[model samples]
Target: MPSPADTLTSDEPVGPQLATPPAISIQDLRIDYGSHLAVDNMSVDIERGVIYGLVGPNGAGKTSTFKALASLLKPTLGKIYLNGHDIVTHQRLAQANIGYMPDMAPVASDLKVWEFLDMFAGAHGLSGKEKSTRIDECIALVDLHSEYHAMCTSLSRGMMQRLVLAKTLLHRPSLLILDEPASGMDIKSRVGLRNILRNICKSHGATVLISSHILPELTEMCDEIGILHKGHLLDSGPVHDVLHRMTGLLPEIKIRLAEPPDMHWKEWLLAQEYVSNILGEDATHFSFHFEGEESDLAELLRRMITQGYLACRVSERQRSLEEILLDLEYDGH
Candidate 1:
């Protein structure tokens, strides 16, 4: 398969996040439909001022969990706390602390973008100059200043999604819970969403919990990630650590010879036990899977140098989050 070189893939742009008390805490969370359980005994802790991605397949209960958090669905058992308030008991306060944007957002064709934001701002108790000021701030926050006065119905799908996001942020929520926010967005729109969310986490220090089928974008946008499957939380941690522990994934390594080697380099590599799934036989670059001892790679490098291969560079390449997650599914995890 051709690699997604044009896709945004990085853990660097989001920057450093220090550990803090849990902004979101759940214990023994369960949601059931009659006798059917959508989520069972799933628990997770999302830190303050961090963007946590909840990744899973369609039936993995991602949306169910989000609904429970937003107070739209009551849990059968267990507790969820948002910014220190219990969601069940202090429902109104918890809801106030959270800004939830579901997969489908409601935007009126009759009103302009700012008017829609103004309506929500007033509903949230903002009035007079404060409401107007906050509306403008939110419009700018979502990078919708150019369309500030435009009719909401005339916007593109991406712009409409962004407008909904501005409305969600108008109340200055302490926690943001978004489900499939980029569902119908273009590549440029997806990248723009990534940047906006990252800035929100860094500058505003708000806790965010988001899920998207766009795994590649999640890798670039989130500070931590939780993988859920069949209503179970498989793993959760910082992106780099989760990527490393993603099903004992073997990282691919490439060895580049200074020149086309006429010697027996291919034969030597093929003979190695850990060097399986070799990709190419080109004289310049040889790539293979390496799951052996880390020390073995050093030994292999020395041997290659001694064999007159003139090793110019040896580097490791990891598969993307999507690749690793696919393997995880095939393995029934």
Candidate 2:
């Protein structure tokens, strides 16, 4: 299967540019409730056919941004464009291409899965054989074909989430806005949802904008992510790039020796300019922070081997997204 990166670059011609508009663009977006401000001057652009993750803690204005993008809320200040159509003035045209699934969106207990989808399909102006075909296709896309006839209330939380996802896809919307989509999902369900989302972008060229407080989920699933704090966008871009900028790109390096080493090992490691925060687990195990380029790290390993330290294993680990966010919150950023 094609990855989102593959979908982006595959079969495209090399040329000056067609200047294709982004899937969603928000400029100076601000949302307020009476005297309270929710979103403040947030601006971002989502390229087509990518899973863009909106990440923030609660009260970060994620929902307000989604509501404005979905055209369900009027921004106190800002202009939004969906596929080059102004969301404020061209609401119908913009809305016709958006599929929004808010957090905790309810489902009817009396209707069967297919029936629920069928009702939405008709509402989207689909009918007869056309509607039926589209419904079946969406069901299969969300991997709910076997549960097509199951009652809504009989489904598991994961299955119900997929059902709602199928409903969102009924009209084949070009943009998907999902808020906290993995809120109640188990590990298996979350994995399935991730795969399905990747397939959607790869196979259909649909752009997905999903928000979640689950840091590792977004890190693993999103092609790009934006960090929001107190209704402000702190940073946005590729995962590692943003992390590198925010955390100085320092990676913790763990090392293991083939056997117990002489005390000189610690002295030599500390003598290196780029190493810091060195800690030892045992006689032959230790870790430290390496602040250097990739080439420099490789050279340091070679020096270790050349010094007859009998290095057995070396690995690098960056700070997790959760830890980074926690630091941000602690600093009140």
Candidate 3:
């Protein structure tokens, strides 16, 4: 994985976000099939030039919401705007600004990779030299230049994904709505896709709204994420912010003692107001959840080493998405 500094550069634009309308603005969006409600009243605003992830379990309304945003499905109620253009009333303008790629995006079995891209480029109004140059650029962007002339069927599953992604990029749309784009990709291809998406955000200033079942992958790539369950958005924000919002979750603290302490030491540690869920006792190391502020933890650590003379190393960790989501799912039940 790339370091934080490498993946998230300070040079990326952050201010003036509100000066321009959000790349995507969903208002009271709802989708229903007969008596079954697939999506509830979900509202979210995705800023420009950032990757926003939407994740949920099976039948979680992810696809329903995505279709509505892509203008492929008319919501039972609500409005969707892409770059300030209403999807229903100004579809042409809205569609012109977005490229939607669904899971298992198909390709022409008889067409070569470049030919496939060429067709979309022409449809997008490119002509002659411009069309050819765009095809080449998109192919290179996906790292499929090596397979430029190969038959779409001949390409591997991962390569097929790349071909569709290249197709999605032909018009350089400002908003990219990709549903499970990395579904069939291998580890290397997944990494390449992450890098490509980041580059697209940096260079082209495109906002990516992607959905995936893989929670951890989104954690690494997206600037923000929304958790959808049974059509309702449980929470959405930066990873740490969402983590802290979930109940029963706190910053975890691990303590490495200078040596194994007596039984009384456990009681003393439990006496701390902020400490909870202490674990392990057979060794010099132990861990617990801390519900207090950073200053409280620092003071507690100081007291432990100074008064108890048993502490050595103390470190803090944020909970992972898997842990938070599991608690969320359980709580919903």
lDDT of all the models against the reference? 0.82, 0.85, 0.83
Ranking 1 against 3 by TM-score, winner: 3
Best by TM-score: 3
**Model 2 regions more than 4 Å off:** 1-18, 248-250, 255-261, 271-274, 282-285, 290-315
Give lDDT: candidate 3, residue 59: 84
**Superposed model 3: Cα runs more than 4 Å off:** 1-18, 247-251, 258-263, 274-276, 281-283, 290-306, 309-313, 328-332
User: Which tens-of-lDDT digit does each residue in 1-333 have in candidate 1?
Assistant: 113432224442211233444788887999999988899899888888999999977788999999999999999998887765567765665566689999988788999988899888888889999999999888876788999889998999888888888888888887999998997788987888888788888888888999998888898899999988878888899988887777464678887889987756677787976788877657698888888777998888887788787889888876667876676577675
Worst 10 residues of 1 by lDDT: 6-15
Best by lDDT: 2
In candidate 1 the C-alpha lDDT for residue 161 amounts to 89
Name the weakest run of 10 consecutive residues (lDDT summed) in model 2. Answer: 7-16
Candidate 3 lDDT by residue in tens digits, 1-333: 223432324454332235688898888999999999999999988889989998877788988988998989999998887877677866676677789999998789999988888888888889999899888888888888789889989999888988899999988888999999998788888998999999999998999999876778888999998888889998988866765665353677888999887777778888988888899855788989888887898898888887665787888766677776676577675
What are the per-residue Cα lDDT tens digits for candidate 2 across 5-94?
323343443222337878888889999999999999999988899899988777889999999999889999988988766788667756
Error of 2 at 27 (Å): 1.6
Q: What number of clashing residue pairs does each candidate have, in the order they appear?
A: 0, 0, 0
| Model 3 weakest lDDT span, ten residues long | 1-10
